[model samples]
Target: MAIGRAKIKSVGAAQSPLLGAAMFTPAVLYILLLVAGPFFLAIFYAFSDARIGNTEMHYVGLENFRSILKSPSFRIAIRNSFIFTICSQIVVIVGANILAIALEKTFRGRGFIRFLILLPWVAPIALGAIGWKWILDSIYSVISWVLVALHFYKPFNAPMWLGEPHLAIASVLLVHSWRLMPFSTVILLAGRTAIPKDIPEAAAVDGAGFWRTQFQIIIPMMRPILSVAVLFGLIFTFTDMTVVYILTAGGPFDSTQTLPSLAFAMGIQGSDLAAGAAISLFLVPLLIIIAYFMLRVAHRAEVN
Candidate 1:
């Protein structure tokens, strides 16, 4: 009897992991169907001849990818995607860090300020971009009027923020960062509060000044959350389309076009489905590398 009881206990313990995995099976299946499945289809289409307005697909065997590689616009889109992602991530991360620190302090109207800070994130991106579109309009821009009123810019004249090449790219980055910084700020704020006050207090007693304590103790402790914020920011900014579509439409001679927008134009608008799939898959390699690094960083931070 004692032997039988021990055998039963061992059997139950051995099944626990299997049961746990079974519990998560639904989520696993959902991701496979909705995310991984579509991605595999896109990868397949990238190598095939799948034109828009056609129900038939023929295997072209790398012709689509070869054509994409030979296209000048593909190169331009790749460059624009990198520039936009890097610039927006820098602006958003820095802005969020400063804002998070400010919000950590107890001050008058702090609650109201926090509410206002998050308004951009709450607002729909399409709506926000459309609003910015008018504000950046060459003829009837209130921002232009305000600048003219300040005598800092010329009156009765404004460069088309969405029409000029450099200005349009800058405008897209500014809008993307503006809409995303609040979420990063909230994440960093959570990280800040998670830190034990005694740690910083002990560092202060060790003759560490404000900046020294922040660098030595605070940032190290906040590393995990910051990594999360940066990873999220990089992915979203890298693939964003709504801001560019509503504001610039890849205009000023397609100088402002990023990969996502280019993909949309090719697949949906231009009816070059195979080429679009190739463009869409172009970033997969970079995204996989980034995700791996982010996981490693997160794991290391947690272990430390």
Candidate 2:
């Protein structure tokens, strides 16, 4: 009986490595097929004279990059991408923190409130953006109707949320913030819950007020979680074209154009695949740097 049990244990140990590899194979294939394949294809297209419906291609070196560099719309798209991403992140972090704090406390209807808050993030982004489009429409806007009823503006003179350049940009930023805030809030709320209950109780006993406890004690403890939230938010906001595409279509003369939207407009819509690929590649370096620093912060927090 002892020898039979020993033989079974040896067989289990021998199969463990194969079991792990079998489980991991799907994820590896997924990345290669879905992620790495497109990445490499984009690189090839960026360097070659590739265009939509082209039957043949030739290596163009830096020609595509040079061509896009001279376009004024490219510069504007780059500027708008940064503005929307940074501004939305700031708004999301602050708003999410407030929401997380409020929801941390037990209250009546908390679950229902949380579900309502999470709706924007959980719903398809295109659907949310389309809804926002109607809400911000120039003539038939619900917001404009409310404003006119409140005498904030005349019936015909209501602000053009998606028409004027500045307002269009603001409208896009608002949509981005609204979509991202709930995700950040859930992350922060989870982080808050992970803190030992005794830590805050001790702070209270030591006469530390709410602000002091939050800023000094709670916030510092959540550095890793905050870093993760900001990293994901940055990537989502930076690469997102749905909100801008659906809301403004980079309209009012491309005031709300972002890099992703510009890439789509140039590559897919305009049929200049090479130029679009090159424009899309511009996002790689900035994202890499952001990811590196954010990951380092997360690692340091883990160590400490």
Candidate 3:
């Protein structure tokens, strides 16, 4: 009896790894079908001359790519997209960090403060942009009215916030950051909370000032979470189009066009499905690079 029981126990232990693998197999297969499958299809469509109206798809080699590279509008859209993405991420990351830190501290009405800050993030981006559009209108902007009242500018002197190139870019960046900051802030706040208070206290007891403790101890400890926040922020900001689409539609003469918006214009709106697919596929390479580096960093972070 004892020998038979031992054999059964050993067999169960041996099957555990296989069972775990089998459990995850469904999720792995789901991801492959849902993500990898569409990705390859998009790549094929991007490279080929696949049109909506045409029944035949002839591979034109690099002509589509060449057109994307040479077209002045495409170049401008790419540049603007980069600018908007970078600027928005900067604002979101910095502002989120500050807000997260502030909210992490015990204070009066901290809960209320957090709720208010999170409202913008919870709101729909398209609706928010539309509301902001009205507020930023050349003739009806409340900001313009305030400026006029304060003698900062006359009734008709308000700058064209969405109708001008530089101003439009700034406006879109501001809108995107405002909408995204709250979400990032919440994420960072969760990260900050995971940090042990003893770490900072120990640093402080060792003759480290508040600033030093924050930089050398607190920030270091929070690196993993911050990395996560940054990664999320980057991915969201990189692919965002709703706010830009509703607010400016790459307006002010396509000054605020990002890759997603440009892709929509070229693919869906312009009925050039192949070009849109190509532009959409452009995001994959960047995502792959980012994912590689982020995973490497995350792994190191875990080991540390």
Candidate 4:
């Protein structure tokens, strides 16, 4: 009986890997179909002379990429994309860390405060951008009206939040930061909570002041999670188009145009699908490179 039971157990154990593969097969197929299919299609479009309003696509070699690279507008879009992503991430990291630290502390109505902070992240980007547009409207801006009421600026002279290049970029950056902050804050808060309680207490016992402990111990130990937060923030901000589309739509003389916005304009609106695909492809390589380095650093931090 014992020998028979042992044989049955061995057979069951032998099937475990197969069972796990079966369970994961559905997800793998789903990703390949939905995620990879579109990606491969985009790659094909980038290399071909695919245009809107026309079904024919011919092999164009590197023509689309070369044209986009040589285009002055494309260059400007690249610059604006970098600026928007970097500035927003800077704001996100600093603001998120501070907010996370504060929120992680026990307090009255902590849940409510967290919910309010998370609203911007949970809300749909398009919907949120529309709300912000109303607040920053050119003609009937609440901010402009409030400023005028406070004697900060004259009527009809309020700053054009989306009409001026500098102001437009700044507004987009602020909006992106607002959207990403809650997510980053939550990530950092989880990092903070994951930390062993004894570390902070020991730091205090060692006469480490608030600044010293935060800078020297807590921050260093949280490197992995911080890198992840920043990585996510970079990816989101770098690839984002919704906020820009609804808020500014790469307005004020293409000054606020990022790669995604420019692609939308040229590919969809201008009917140069190949060029738009090429423009969007510019981000993929850069993103992959960044993610690789960041992940390497994060891995090292974890090992340490």
Please provide, for model 3 over 73-162, each residue's C-alpha lDDT reduced to its tens digit, 9 standing for 90 to 100.
Answer: 778778876787778888888888789878988999998999999888788778889999998888898988899999998779988888
Candidate achieving the largest lDDT: 2
User: Across residues 203-252, which tens digit of lDDT does each residue of candidate 1 receive?
Assistant: 99999999999888898888888888988888988888898888888887
> Is 1 or 2 the stronger prediction by TM-score?
2
Off by over 4 Å in 2: 1-9, 12-22, 297-304
For all candidates in order, the CA lDDT equals 0.88, 0.94, 0.84, 0.91
| lDDT preference between candidates 1 and 2, better one | 2
Candidate order by lDDT, highest to lowest?
2, 4, 1, 3
Candidate 4, residue 195: lDDT: 94
Q: On a 0 to 1 TM-score scale, where does candidate 1 land against the true structure?
A: 0.87
Lowest summed-lDDT stretch of 10 residues in model 2?
293-302
Instruction: Estimate, for each residue in 106-184, the C-alpha lDDT of model 2 and write its tens digit.
Output: 9999999999999999999999999999999989999999999999998799999999999999999999999999999
**Model 3 per-residue lDDT at 148:** 91
Could you tell me every candidate's TM-score relative to the true structure? 0.87, 0.91, 0.85, 0.89
Q: Which stretches of candidate 1 lie over 4 Å from their true place?
A: 1-29, 297-304
lDDT of 3 at 279: 83
